[model samples]
Target chain A: MAALGFGLAYAGFLGLCLAMDRHHAELLRGRPAAGRRWLLRGVGWLLLGLSLLPCLALWGVGIGIVAWLGLLTVAAYSLVHLIPYAPRLALWLGPLLPLAGLALSLAPT
Target chain B: MKQGFRQCMAWLHTWSGLLVGWILFAVFLTGTASYFRGEISDWMRPELHAPAAGGEPAILAIETLKRLAPDSPTWFVFPPGERNSELRVVWRNPPGKPTPPGSRGFGNMVLDPATGEPVTARESYGGEFFYRFHFQLHMPPLWGRWVVGFCAMMMLVAIISGVITHRRIFADFFTFRPGKGAGRSWLDAHNALAVLALPYHLMITYTGLITLMLMYMPWGVQAVYKGDRGGFQAEVFGVAPPVRRANQPAPLAPVGPLLEEAMRRWGGPPGRIEVQQPGDASAIIRLTRRDSEQISSNPQTLTFDGVRGTLLGASGEPGAAAATRGVAYGLHLGRFASPLVRALFVLSGLAGTAMVATGLVLWAAKQRHRHARAGRAGFGLRLVEALNLGTIAGLPTAMLGYFWANRLLPLHLADRADWEVYCFFLLWGLAALQALFWPGLRSWATQFAAAALLGLLLPVLNLLTTHRHLGVSLPAGDWAMAGTDLLVAAFGLLLGLLSWRLFRRAGRAPVTRPVRGAGLARAEGA
Candidate 1:
C-alpha cells in the first residue's frame, strides 16, 4: 500500500514537471503542444490528487502527507537523472508507472 | 556589511555551512542511523536473535522484577515489540533519596521472554553509541549538548541563508549534471539535494533546535517558574513533581489491576510503570502509555495510589503551546512513525547528510580550481580535501570496525563497551591520517574502498563468529537479522561502486577551465 502511494505520488510529480515548458523541451521532442500541455496538466493534477487516496487509506492523514512528499522527491530525483540519456523512458514513466504500482499493490502479499 | 541581502545570505550560507559542515555531516549521518537504533542494537547483540513472540509482556516484566528488584522503589520495562525482541527491565531507587544531585541509581538487564532468563548479550554500546555521539560527540553530557546546540544554530542559519541565496530553487531541483566539472558537479549535487528535500531539511533542523531550546533559550521557563526547571516540566507536561517519601511501611497493591485500569482509561497499552515509594503508604503508581501510539511523542501518564489501587486522577491535558512543542519534538524524534514512514525519514536524513557533504566538497573543489589557476592547490584546499575524505568515508569505516570489534573481542575483556568505542575512534583517526597523506582523489577512493571491503565482509564475519548468517536468518524468517545483513552488503556494494566511479572520474582529465555554454554559466559563477 505504501509502495503504491509512493509510486503514484512520484509519477504524478514527474507528470507535472514534464508538463512544464522547460522540462518538456529538454526531455521530449520540442515543446509540449498546447492541447498536450493541458492534457498533461489535467492528468498530472488528477494523478497527484488521486495519489492521496492510497496513502490516506494506508497510513492516515498526518503520515500520508509526509510519505507522499517523500515519494514525490524520490520520483522527481530519479526522473531528473533519467532525462539526460533515457528521455523516452522518463517520458513514459510518468503515465505508466502508477498503473503498474497499483496492480502490484492490489496483488496479495 | 554593505552587501545586498542575497549577497549577505550567500556569504552567511557559505561560511556558516563550511565552518560547521564537518560536524553537521557527522551529526546528520549518525542521526540518520539512529532512526534504526533499535534494529541496529538488535544486530549488535546477535545472541538475542529470538523471534518476537505473543506472550504477555507485562506478566513477564513482573516476573523479572520480582526476581531482580522486588523492593526497589521504581521500575521501567521496555516490552518486546514487532522489531524489538528483548524484554528490558530497569529498577531504580526513589527520588529524594539521592546519592548525588541529578544522579539516577538504577540497574538494568535484558531478558528472554520465553524463559525469563537474563540474556547476556555482548557488552557493547551498539546503536546507542551513534545516537549518543550525534548530540554528545562523546563529550561530557553538558558540554556535548551545548556544542551540539551551537552547531544546530549554525545549521538552521545555513538552511535559511541557503534558501535565500538560491535564485532559481525550483529550477535547480530538476538539474544535476554529474559528469560536469568537479566544482559544477558538487554544486549541482548540493543544490539538488538541498532543494529536493527542502521541507524536510528545514523541519528537521528547526525541530532539532527546538528539542534543545529549553537549554538554549531558558528565559521563558526561568521567568515563569523562577528558575525551577522541574516545576516548568511538571506544569508544561501536567505531571506531578516528586514527593517526599512517607517512610511508613504498608503492603503494596498488585500492579496488574492498575496497569489494566490505566490501559482501559487511556485506550492504549501501558509502556512503563513507576512505583514511587513502592513499600510505603505514600506509594504512587504511574502508568505511562507508549509514545509510539500517539501523534504527540509525550507519553501520557495516569497516577494511582499504590496501596489501594485507587485513581489519583490523570495529568491535565497540555495547553496549545506545550502540545505544539510536543508534536514538534515528536516529528523530530519520529518515534511515532511506522516502519515505512521511519524508512522515509532515514532517506530524507541521508539526503540531508549528502547535502552537507556535497556542500563541503563544492567548497574544496572551487578552492582547488582557484588554487590550480595559481599553480599549486594550496594548504587550505588540501586541508579541506583531507578533512572531507576523513569525515565522509572515515566515520562509516569506524562504525563497521566497531561492529567487527564486538564479535572479535573476548567477552571477558574489562570495560568491553569502552573498548568497542575506543576501536571506533582509533580506526577513524587512522583513516584521517591516511587521508592527510593521500589527499584528494586517492584519499576519497582508498577510504571508500576500505569501507566497502569491511561492509562487504560484515555478514561473512557475522556468520563465522555466530552461526546466524543471512542463509540461516532469511530461511528462518528472521527479517531483522536478514535485513541487516542484506542492507550492509548493499551499502558495501554502493561504496564499491562510488569508489570505482571516483577512481575513473579522477583518471579523466581534470577540467581546469570552466566550459563556456548556455546552462553552464551558473556553474562558472558559483
Candidate 2:
C-alpha cells in the first residue's frame, strides 16, 4: 500500500513539476497562453487528486478501473486531436504517460 | 537510383520489419508470458505446488539448502516472490555429469519441497525458455541471438520510418469502425494503439536494441582489446566475480546462513546464486535479490567469499553499471515490479500485438488499390500478402493447437511436454504453408476455424485424457487448470465467430493474387 501510494505520489509530483516547468517556460518566453496554463493547472490538480486517492482504501478498485479507462481514453483523444504533428503530440503525452500508467495501476482490483 | 535512397531505406525498413513482425509478435507474447515463469511452473507442476510458502523462508531455506546441495559449489534458493510462491533451489553440475530424465532446466535442479530431493516436475523449461527464446529463439546460441537482434534492429528502423510514413496518425485514432472495410478498421486500430502508446513503442524498441547492442556491434570491442567474450562479459556485466582456482579444493560455504542473512537484510530471499570456479582456487557465492515489485529495476546481489564467507561488495548499490543492467533487465522482465505494473505490462503487450496486427492489415488494405492497378503484381506482392495473412491469422491457430497438443499427447510419453511445444511451431509452419497455397479468404476462414475447433475441443480433449475439465475444475475453484481450459474455450468460441464472418466474407468475393511463394520467411515462431 505504501509502495502504491509513493509511486502514485511521485508520479503525480513529476507530472506537476513538468507541467509547471513547461508552463513557466512559456511565460518566461513571453508566450503566455492563458488557455494552456489553465490546461496545465487542470492536469496538476488531476494528478494531485489521483495521488491522494490511493490513501482511500475502499474506492481504490473502482477508481483504478476508471483511471485505466480515463488514461487510455485521454491518450486516444490526445492522439486523435493532434493532427499531422505526431512529434508534438508525443512530446506532450510522453512524460504524462508514466504518470498515466502509474496512477492507473494504483487503483485496487 | 539516387532519387530512391529515401524510398529504398523505407522499403528496406518496411520489408525487413514485415518479414519479422509476426515472429516478433510471438516473441513478445511468449516473453511476456514468462514474467510469471515461476507461477507458470507451479501451475504446470501441480504436485510441487506449495501454499505460496506460508512460513518464514528461513527454516525452509536452511532445511532445503542443507538437504539439497551441501556438496555443490553454491546452493541457491529463489524463495518465492509477490506473484509466485514455492521455493526453488539450484545447483550446478558439469556438462558431462549424468542428468536425470525429466529435468526441465539445464545445469540446475529444482528440489521437491516435500523431501528436498532433486525431482522432476512435468517438463517445463517454463518461462525461462520463452525468455531465452524471445531474443534468439532456441536456435544454436549466439547465431540465434544475432538473427533476433538483427530483426529487432529492423523493427527499430521500421518504427521510425513508420512514424515518418503515417500522415494521418492522429486523425485515425479512435476511428476503428467494426464491420467497416478490414483495411479501414485495421488502420484505426493501428493508429490508435501505436500513436497512443508511441513512447512505449519507442522505449521498448530502443531498450530492446540496447539490450543486445554489444552483440550486434562487436567490432568496437574487437578493436579495443583482445576478443575474449567472457572477459568482456565480466567487465561489462561486472556482476560475476573473476574466476579463481580454489587451491587445495576447499569445501564451500553453507547457503542457509547467507540466505537467512540476505532475507533478513532485504526482506526477501535471493532469487539466484552464482558459484565462481566450482571447485577451483577462488570460489565465491553470490545471492541475488528478486527485486521489489516497483516499476524501477534493482535486484541487489550480495557476493561472499565461498570458503571463508567473507562479505564481498553488494552488486546493486546504485552507482555501478551492474546496477544499471539490473534495472534494465528488471524493466524488460517486468516481473520484479508489483502485480499492477505487471498487469499494465500485459495490457500494453496485448495492445502492442494488436497494434502490429492492425498495422499489417492496414498496409494490406492501403495496397489493395495499388495492387489492383498494377496488373504486373508478381510473387513479391503476393508473397507479402500471404505472409501478412499467415502471421495475422495463423500464429493463433498454431498456439491453440499447442494447448490442444498438451491435452491430446499421451501423458506418459517420454519427452512429451517439450514435443508438444515443438508441435506448436510445426503446426504453425504448416499453417504458413496453408496460407500460401489457399486463397487468402479461405486461409483466414480455415485457420480461424482450426483455432476455434482446436481451442473449443481442447477442454473435451483434457476430459478424455486427464478426466479434468472446466465444469468440475471451476466448481472446485481449481483456477489454474480450469481457468486455462475455460479461457481456451472462450477464445475458441470467439475464433468460431470470426471464422463465420470470414467464411461469409469469402463467399462474397473471388479475391485473386499471384501464386504464393511459401512465405515462411516472416513466420518467426517465438
Candidate 3:
C-alpha cells in the first residue's frame, strides 16, 4: 500500500512536469499543445488526490496525511533528479512504477 | 517597490543563512544521525550480542536496581524495547550524600536482559554523543542550547525570506542543471534541495525551537506562575510532588504484578519505571507509557503505592495546549514513527543537510567568482571559504574518527569515553589548521579524501577488531550491526566520488564566467 502511494505520487508529479513547457520540450521533444497541457494538468491533480487513498488506508487519518506529504516530497525530488539526467527514463518509470506497485499489492504474503 | 522589497529580503536571507551556516550544518548532520542513536548504541556494545532473552526485562531490571541502589531515593529503569536491547537503569543519590566515584549524584548501568548482569562492554558514549551534540554542540548545556536556539531562529528567517525572494519557485520546481557552470549549478542544487523538502525544513526548525522553548522564552511561565517555574511544570506536566522518605525501611513489593497491571491498563508496554523512595514506607512507583505508542512525547504515567503495590492514580489526558506542544515535540523527535516513516524522515533530514551544504558552497563559489573578476580574493571571501571547507568536510572526518577511536581505544584506558571525544576534536582541529594554511581546492580534496578513507575503512576495522563484523552479523540477522557497516561504507563511497571530482577539478585552471541568470540568482540569494 505504501509503495502504491509512492508510485501514484511519482506518476502524478510526472504528469505535472509533462504539462510544463520546458520539461515537456525536454522529455517529449516538442512543446505541449494547449489542450494536451490542460489534460495533463487535470490528470496530474487527480492522480495526486488519488494517492491519498492508499495512505489513508495504510496509516490512520492523522499520520496518513503526514505520510502523504512526505511521499510527495520524495516523489517530486526523485522526479527532479531523474528528469535532469534521464528524461526519457524518468517518463517511462512513471507508468511502470504504478504497475509494479499494483503487481506487488496483489501478490500473496 | 516589489523588486526593492525582494532585494532586501534576498540580502536578509543571505546573511542570516551565511552567518551561522557552519553551525547549522553540524547540527543538522548530527541530528539526522540521532534518528538511529539506539541502533548506533547497540552496535557499539558488541559484548551483548546474544538475541533477546526469554526473561521479562522489567523483572530483571527491578532485581538489578534493587541490589545496586538499595538506599537511593529514586530509581529509573528503562527496560529493553524495540530500539534498544539493553535494560538500562539510573538512580539518584540521597540528598547531601557524597556521590560515588565516576558519578555526579547519579549512577547508571547497562544490564544484559538475558542474565540480568552488567554488560562489561568497553566504556564509550556511543550514539548519545551525537544526540547530545545535535542540539548542545558539546558546550555547557545552557550555552550550547542557547547558541543552537539562536541559529534555529536565523534558519527560520532565512527560510521565509528565501521563499519571498525566489520568484520562479514553481516554474523552476523540477529544474536542476548540474552541467551548468559552478555558480549556476550550485544555485540550482541548493534551490532544488531547499524547495523539495521545504515542509520538513519548516517543521524541524519550528519544533526544534519548541523543544527548548522554556529556556528561550520563559516570559510566559514567569507571567503565569509568578516565576515559580517548578510549580508551572508540575501543573502543566502532571508531575506529582515528591514523596518524602518515611525513615522506616520497608521491603519493596514485587514489581512483576504491577508491571502486568500497567500493561493491561495501557494496552502497551511501559517505557520507563520510576520508583521514588524505593526502600521506605512512602515509596511510590510510576510507570510511563512508551514513546512509540503515541505521537506525543509527553508521559502518561500511572502511579502506585510502592510498599503496598496498589494503584494510586493515573495522569489525565493533557490539555489542548499541552497536547499540541507534545505533538510538536514528538514530531521533531520522530520516536513514534515506524521504520518506513523513519526512513522518509532520514531522507528529508539528508536533503536539509545538503541544502545547507550547497548554500554555503554557493556563497563561496559566487564570492570566488566575483573575486576572480576583481583580480584577487579579499580577506572576507577567503575567511568564508576556509570556514566552509573546514566545517563541511572536516566535521564528517572528525565524526568518523570518533567511531574509529571507539574500536581502537584500549578497554582499560582511564576516562575512555572522554578520550574518544577528544580524538574527535583533535582531528577537527587538525583539519581546521590545514584549511587555515591552505584554503584552496586542493585542501578541500585532501579533507574529503581523508573523510572517504576513514569512512570506508571503518567496516574493515570492525572486522579486524571485533567479532561482530558483517560476516557474523549478516548471517545472524543482526541488522543493527550490518546496517551501520553498510551505511558507513556507502557514505564513504559518496565522499570518495566527491573527493575524486574535487581532485580532477583542482588539476585544471580556475574558470570565471559571468554567471547566467546572475540577476535572478542574486535576487534569490542562492
Docking class of 3: medium
Model 2 residue A44 CA deviation in Å = 11
DockQ of each model against the real complex? 0.56, 0.11, 0.77
Off by over 4 Å in 2: A1-109, B1-13, B51-75, B84-88, B94-107, B171-174, B177-179, B223-225, B228-256, B275-284, B292-299, B305-312, B316-324, B373-377, B456-497, B507-526
**lDDT tens string, model 1, B365-460?**
677666555656566666777788789989988878887888899987998989999999999999888777755564577788988998899899
> lDDT for every model?
0.78, 0.60, 0.86
Task: Please provide TM-scores, in order, for all candidate models, with all chains considered together.
Answer: 0.91, 0.73, 0.95
Please give the TM-score that candidate 1 achieves against the real structure.
0.91
Estimate, for each residue in B214-311, the C-alpha lDDT of model 3 and write its tens digit. 99999998898989988998898898888998999998888888889887987877999999999899999999999876777888999999999999
> How many clashes does each candidate structure show, in the order listed?
0, 11, 0
lDDT score at residue B6, model 2, on the 0-100 scale: 58
Which window of ten consecutive residues has the lowest lDDT sum in model 2 chain A? A23-32
Fraction of true contacts reproduced, model 2?
Answer: 0.12
Off by over 4 Å in 1: A105-109, B1-3, B49-55, B94-104, B259-268, B509-526
**Cα lDDT of model 3 by residue, A1-109, tens digit:** 8888889999999999999999999999889999999999899889899889888998788677777888999999999999878888899999998888778777897
